[model samples]
Target: MTDQPAVPTDDPTVLTDRDLEVLAEQLGREPRGVVGIAARCVCGRPLVVRTAPRLPDGTPFPTTYYLTHPGAVAAASRLEAQGVMREMTERLGEDEELAAAYRRAHEHYLARRAELGQVEEIDGISAGGMPTRVKCIHVLMGHALAAGSGVNPLGDEALALVRDQWRPDRCSC
Candidate 1:
């Protein structure tokens, strides 16, 4: 039989700004920034290109801007689910579903964090505690996504209690 072209299974080529914007929309948040892209070969492994800062050698790093692929998203979602599970195990303890959701969200946050690195604090406090450098981006992005998804991580009563104590209007004044 004639040799059929090898089927590609990589993540996909680098994505354009527009592509990133679309992914952001799917995520219900603004695209942070373009870091790099990756392509998955037919074997389904990532061929990554490092974007943004260049390597010392000055050769453009492989694939940074990855084309959006269903497999990639699915893989990300799975990792996120795992992270959520880890958090729940630590915080809530033994929650299968909540932990799963948290893990899923966590995976997404970790990926984004890898790309964005640490962001400046937003001048606020979360129920967990004051923001710290290590997990600042995770907390902020989690809050944003939770708010956007209408899934309040903090119950209404807890929020109200916090609000009463730290009223923005009064606190600033």
Candidate 2:
């Protein structure tokens, strides 16, 4: 029996020095440690990353980082919103004709909803319903139209008709 402390099976909560170095390389900056990582998230508020620092018995475990700062979280939210808007604008374009078509289709949907007594309780309509199914077809058509290459409008209309036929009312009739 050798008189030596049992080799700790526990892992470190902080990133290994090598791991930190690699992270720094990927991030293109020097990360001093967890504090540095946390500081990066901090803009106007402290962006603390909560992590599982240890096991049940205080044995060190892998760190799991989470954003805890409101400002950092808000910034992330803004970035996501901007990305979505940019994508929508890029895909849909600012074309007057296309915009008018979408508006007309949307108005039709609204009218259909009102006729079905579904305007107040929007959840009343099922995905299998005529209006909802047609809405989906419109969405697909919009995507196809947005491609802006050699898209066949007749094919889009035909596909929309096929989709409309699959609706519960049409299927039953």
Candidate 3:
């Protein structure tokens, strides 16, 4: 992994017009409930988006941090196809320390989401299949990028694997 720039967690609270346009281009649809930017690429492109707990239609959305960068998403998909999530989940079961840390990550995610707003439907649930299994690398990496390093072990691992393809140090914008 390369020496990447630190992802400042203190991001913009609201998405700008350009942010929305770029996000739409990246996602292939209009982004819904995007409350803030959780992380960005070195070129200042939006990488991770923090969503609202509930949508305008009153649907409870659980995924707080959404990964948007195409390169990073593609890389994470490659790892997922390689069964990285399964292996990481197995590792979580074997390593108590890692599991504990992951649980904390889950807690941190919940707390952060709580700061935005609380939807009782998703009170303690954290996104990206946290605290139990390694489900989605996109979720994990988004959480890692948004929360910074040393927060999500599996996320960190996924990020390390994708560094060659998409590192936060260099902007692909």
Best by TM-score: 3
* Superposed Cα deviation of residue 81, candidate 3 (Å): 0.5
Report how far residue 63 has shifted in candidate 1, in Å.
Answer: 25
- Which residues of candidate 3, in runs, are more than 4 Å off? 1-6, 12-14
List ranges where model 1 is wrong by over 4 Å: 1-91, 117-161, 167-173
Model 2 lDDT, full chain set:
0.31
1-173 in candidate 2: lDDT tens per residue? 13221121112343356546544443356532242222221111122222233334544422223333333234334434545324433334545554455444444434423332332334333221122122232233222222221232321343334442321112110
Cα lDDT for residue 57, model 2? 53
Per-residue lDDT over 8-102 for candidate 3, one digit per residue giving the tens place of the 0 to 100 score: 55455556899899999999999998988889877677889998999888999988999998988998999999999899899889999999999
RMSD of every candidate to native, in Å, equals: 17.0, 23.5, 2.1
How many clashes show up in model 3?
Answer: 0
User: TM-score of the candidate numbered 3?
Assistant: 0.93
lDDT of each: 0.32, 0.31, 0.86
Displacement of the residue 157 alpha carbon in candidate 3, Å: 1.0
TM-score of model 1 vs. true structure = 0.27
Which of the two, 2 or 3, has more lDDT? 3
Clash count of each predicted structure: 33, 0, 0
Worst 10 residues of 1 by lDDT: 128-137
Best by lDDT: 3
TM-score of each: 0.27, 0.24, 0.93
